[model samples]
Structures are given as C-alpha cells and as structure tokens.
Target: MKETAQKYKRQTASRYLPVGAQEITSKIMEAESYGVSTKHDGHFYLLSYDGKKATLTNHGGRVIDDLPLLKEATALLKGKCKTVVLAGELYLHKEGGRTRSFDMTAALDDKSTNIYFAAFDLLSLDGEQVSLDIKALDQKLNTVLSSGKSLHAVKNSFVESRKDIAALYKEIVEDDGQEGIVVRSHNGPTYKIKPLITLDAVILGYAEGQGSRAGMLKEVLVGLCVAKDEYILLTKVGNGYSEEERKNLLKELGKKKVDSGYIEVSGSNVAFTMVAPNQVVEFSCLDVFGENSKGVISKMCLSYKDGTYTANGKQPMASVISPVYVKMRTDKKPDTNDAGLSQITKIISLDINASEKLDVKKSEIVSREVYVKISKGAKMVRKFMVWKTNKEATGEYPAYVYHYTDFSAGRSEMLKKEIKVSDSKKQIEEIFAAEVLENVKKGWEKVKS
Candidate 1:
C-alpha cells in the first residue's frame, strides 16, 4: 500500500490554457482518455456504470486548460467506493502570477484544485462490467442515488414540445439555486441527450373538487413568479399526492381562509378561493398549456416539501377564526355543498391528540381542605335538605326542607318527619346532619349515620 494514486504516474511540463474552444482541449484530453462524450448535443460525462474510469466531454467545461490541475483533479478520486472513471471540469485558482483552480486571491500557495465530480452512469462494480443498456442504467441511478450521492442523471427526454424547454430554461436561470429544469421523453433512452423544458413555476392555488374533495378538488392552481408578481393560471397540478394526502390537504385548506381570489379553472370555479400562501410546493412538470387552468390538468407528479411533518411540528396559530369562513362557504345559497362533521376537524383533533399525549392516570380524590366550627353548648345544630324527583325544577328546591326542621324555641331543633330518599347521597348526608344537630355529633361520625 504505497501512498501513490496510480501504479504509474507521469506529467509533461508543457503548459496549455483552458480558455481555448471546447474541442481542442477535448480532443487533446480525449486522446489521453481524459475528455468525455464525442457528441456535444448536450454536455455530459460519458462514464461506464461503475466509476473506475471516466471521460469528460467539453459541453460546458471551461476549466480544463491547465494540464497539472487536470492531473491533480484526477487524483481526487476515492479508489475504494467504485472502480470507474469520472469526468468533470478541472477548475483552478490564479494567484501571485500563477493560475490555479477554485480559489480566491488567497489559498494560491497551498495548490488545491479539486474536481467537481459529475458522474452520469455506473460503469463497473465488484469486477462486474457495466454492459447494461442506457435504460437499465437510468433505473440503477434511481436505486443507488435515491439516498446517498451517486451519479447525476443526464436529461434526455421531453413531455413537452420545444416551446416548453425555452420557457423553463429562463426560469431556471432566474431561480438562485436551480440548475434549471429538464424535460425528457419517457421512452427516450438516457443517452438520447436532447431534452425540452418548460418554464419553472410556483404554486398559487389548489382545487378541491366539489362533492368529492373531502377527497380532492380534482385540480390545483399553478403560476409563474415574474419579477414581483406571480402570473395567472399557467397550469393546474392534480397528478401528485395520494388519496389520503388529498383529504388531509383539503382539510388543511378548508381551515385557512384565502384573502384574494385564487386563480382557478375558468368554467369550473367552485366556491373555493384564495388561501394562505404559506407553503411553497415544488413540482417537476413537463408541459405548460392554456391561459387559465382547464377543468383538466397535466400528468406530471410533485412532492410536497413539508409533508406530514409540517402538521406535526409547532404549527402556527390561525390568523383568524375559520368558522366564519366555513359558514360562508357552506351556508351560501348558491353553493349546495354542505361540509359535514367529518369534513371539518381542526378544532377537534388538536384537543384529542393533546389529551392523549398528556394523558395521566386518574384515581379517586380525597378532600384536603380544613374546616373549623364552634361546638354548640345546647346540644346540636341540625341540618336538613329536601329534593324533588323532577329534574327540571332543580334550582335550590332543597330550601323547602326548612319547613320540616324546627327552630321555634330560639334554638336549632328536631325533624318534623324522618328524612329518607332511596339512599340518595345529598339527602342521606342532610338527614345525618339534621339528626346530629338535634342531638350531638361532629366530623365524619356526624355524616356517617
């Protein structure tokens, strides 16, 4: 295990600048098995399925002029991961009269020019050569690159015609982080390179269809973000999300009241409108058609960024009560859609989940308050209570018991008759208290009998 990248190493001192056209460096590099795909319909690294060795084509490559950085960039590979070649731009930094890669005026002395590795296909693995067709290799990228980093899949197909690609390209350049969108054909092989893209878009409104959208609105509202404003109804998305997801989403939107009229399907506008523009959902779509959304929408899918986790975390309190809006939507004379109990659950689920999460074991409670009273020298202070079988006439109805107890001799006295009531708790306690006061009893013993 000697500390050297290649079993063999050699570099010529002849200097060449990278600012030359795409082909000269590519031709020279390809001659040395460095530059990639000969065809430049679109730029990509032609790689075997395994990453043991790769060829970099000069589609958008401009950093390859320096020969030393190219050799140094080649050295940046990790030998243990996959035994395949990689192709990418070898960027350098220029400092103190020397041109280098990927540096500010500083770090020129250290001499670090690393390769920005952009892999396309799996060339070989476990000594198994990548003899698979481009279609199978694309499927492999989805499997391997689904989680960790593998190869970047090149765009080769289109759902939209050429018009869509130009519009999307403009949007991609505008978005600060987006590399740009790619429109590819479903049947086109991965190596078919040319892809058409439509304009990038931002969501403005979502449609939940009437009668069924405790299911879904059947369509969603989409638009483009211009310099400051979001354009109207470029398209509507209904392709993504599951049945449960659609239901959950409608439940969320119904809770929120939109202040403005949402861009909607022209003839199919239901009672729904603007909602809180708090969520930014992203979709990779292939086409942009129609002035406003038709009743129908396109077929590409999208994944919501927030997912269920958005509802699970510390959710923002509603800016206003939604029942008024709910009533407005439901009670409108023209709108026959009456939302049912199952349709609205915001105020209920939160309380239920909170109770469950905070559940505590409950047991019988003992009274802890201390009571103090003067002992009567006469004998007792009787108490009496009268109750009615009638549940409606319940207000202080026990006051009639005073008519039965005697206090005529200027002292608390006896019961007019024996008080009894099918072992009623309040009535029994009253009878015992009255008996005690007529004689003498205190504390628990006073109430026990």
Candidate 2:
C-alpha cells in the first residue's frame, strides 16, 4: 500500500541554549544577522494540504486527527493549496490575549474555542519541498496562504546587530503577553529565548523511564507543601538534569524510599513511591496561568473564586507553562525553601520585588557575611554573626550577635543580643553561646530521621 500524503515530516529547531540576554546576543552575533519571531508557548505541528484535504501532524510527525482545531484547519485549508506543508504553532488564546500550552490541551475537547495555526515556514508546495532562499520562502508562504481566520503567518523581523535582537526580545517578553522570541538565521541555526521563572520544589518520587532510560529514573515527581504533611504535585520534570545528575539522584532516591502513594495528575493513573520529601529541586519554566476548562482544572489541586485562581490560597496553580528541572538543590530543605508554587506565583506576578541583578547582589552579600557551622550528627548548617562588643571590652565592637540554624531554609531567625558599653566580655560570650545552642537544637529537629 502506498503511504498517504498526510504522512510528511519536516526538520525542526532542536538546538536549545539557555535563554538569557547574554546567550541570545552571542547567538545573534555568531549569525551576524537573524530573524526574530514570537515563540508561542504551544505545540509545533505541520498543516499539510494534499491538493484536496488538509491534515495536521505534531512536531514528532505523529498524526493528530481528533483535535477540533485540526478538523477546522482541514476545512479552512481545503483547496487552498495544491500540495503544501506549512509549519506553525498550534495554540489557544486565553482571556487576557495570552496563549498557553495547557490551554491548547484543554481546547482539544472544546469545539467552541477557536484554535490558531500561526505558520512561520513553508516546508513544501505542490508535493515538492521548497528549496528557495529563506526570504523567498517566507514571501511565497505569505502569498499562498488564504484569507482564513484560523491560520496566520507569524510576525517576524530581520536584524543585523545584537542590540536590535536584545531590544526585540525585551519588547516581546514585556509587552507581548510574556511570549518568548525565536531568532532564526537564513542558513544558520534557530535559538529561542523566553521569560523563565525558577522555583524550588520538594521531590516526591520518580516515574519509570522508557527506551534508553529504561530502569533508570525518567521523571521526578515534585510538589509544594501547602500545610504540614499536605502537598500539591506540581509537575513531572523530565528535562534539564544531566546524565550524572540522573544517576546520582537515582542513588539518593534509593536511600530515602517510602510507601507508594496516590497523586492526582491529569488523565493518568500514575503511582509514585513516596520519598522522605526532604529533597528539594530547582525548576525553571515559562510561567503559571489559570485554566477555565473543568477537565483540565479538576486535575490540579487549585481553587477558583470570583474569576481568580490560587494554589492553596497562597499561589496561582492554573498550570506551569513548560517546567524543566534545573538542578537538585542539595543545600536547600523542603520546609525552609520558600520557592514553592505560591511564592513563585508572587514573583512572576511581580507582587514581590523581583529583579535578577538585585537578587544576585543580595545573595552575594549574604554568602559573604553569613558563616555556616555544621551541627554534630546532622546534614545541616548553623549560621552566626560575630562582632566586637566595645572598645573597652577585649572583643570586637557592636556586641550584637545573630545566629541562624539553616540559611537556605531560613527557618530560625537571628538571635540578637543588644550590646551595652558597660557589658563585660564574659557576659557577651555567655549570651552568644546560649543562642548558638538553641539555634543548633532547632536545626537538628528539622532533619528527617
């Protein structure tokens, strides 16, 4: 049997680099000139027209026949082209004019919602691949596209300098609903840069891997603790961990095994072996947004009220855009790290003062001043500040002493002692020693047996 015309594959952008101002500038400079387009947070699918009918296939070349969007795309593209393959993003727009990946998943079942295929490239025409220059190909795709509401040619621009690329990226992220930008060169590479939010979440368990990762840890199940012994499973992060990190994590997970428990994830009966929940991992993703779909929203442990959504009344838990595990935070404790769902939501929403430069400077200053002392028989550190009491006293000046149990967890506050000029050296030492012991005890209690 001859293969159907619907079965077509196209090359995609696979080279992913860290999305940052510096990295983007370097990539753009290497190319010397590149085209910048909005990287919509949606699936990449190919809309193919075989002279008569239109077919939609995902980036992986798998046919997607059930989506209402695909059905609509078929009707819209019918007879529009002789034989053409258009590459584009399949996305669903939210109420605030933002497009989300989860919204695309939710819109699959909703026939009323209009799905958009934002075409950016023309892979083939009339059953033959287009071998024209980049600029010519773009122009050809624009001319062939019909006046359809569902399909659109993605807006993009060509720039020669790094400053223009940086400015364009900033404008896209800030003013254009936080959607990322993709910089593509004529005969070079494609790089994507997006506004990413990082957070620390507790690892619950691991899911079994398939293919080459079989018998190894494939995905780590992570969540945020809303209350004592209560948590909401946020996402199953599969990307970002290195091979060494994966092997090390598997060994570590072996040491902290617990009973398998039921966790609710959308459209799956996934069981996880509960761990100590003491291990914290850092993750970075696009952003969090609310979902109005009942089927999609029901899977998440979020509450909706008065046209607003929150996770445990503390953070927004609509859905994390595209979460990727950055690293296993060995220095962080689940209870102490406040980079949970709610905290991340606040930072992303700009409710709390969030600045990359300021945060880095603050962290550097804190690391320099705060000294950590490991407690006896614990994987915990006790931080303390030592200073002089007075000139008359044999010791240092401002007799104020502040001690902390765990710096990353920020559990115990600084035990301060008001210094007086009349206070003796012995009195200051005694006060400091007493506070140190108390902080040490508090730190030990937080460690899981």
> Which clashing pairs does model 2 show?
311-315, 315-342, 388-396, 388-397, 389-396
- 1-449, model 1: which lDDT tens digit per residue? 01111111111000111111212222222111121121111122333223433333332222222333333233433354454433221223222222222132123234334222334445455556565444565565445444322233333332233334344434433432232332222333111111222222344455566564545645455433221232322345565567766777666665543333111232253322444433434343321111111111112111222221011111111111100010112222111122111111221111112211111122221111112234353333233444332321322112212112323233433212222332254654565456545544354222322
Instruction: Score residue 125 of candidate 1 by CA lDDT.
Output: 51
For model 2, the run of ten residues with the poorest summed lDDT: 358-367
Q: In model 1, what is the error at residue 144, expressed in angstroms?
A: 45
The C-alpha TM-scores of every prediction are 0.22, 0.49
Q: lDDT of each prediction vs. the true structure? A: 0.31, 0.56
List the candidate 2 regions with Cα displacement exceeding 4 Å.
Answer: 1-11, 16-18, 59-80, 94-96, 203-275, 279-449
Give Cα distance to truth, residue 377, candidate 1, Å.
58
Cα displacement (angstroms), candidate 1, residue 111, comes to 39
Q: What is the lDDT of candidate 1?
A: 0.31
Please report, as a residue range, the 10-residue window in candidate 1 with the lowest summed lDDT: 318-327
TM-score of candidate 1 versus the correct structure, residues matched by position: 0.22
The per-residue C-alpha lDDT of model 1 at residue 309 equals 8
**Candidate 1 C-alpha RMSD relative to the actual structure:** 27.8
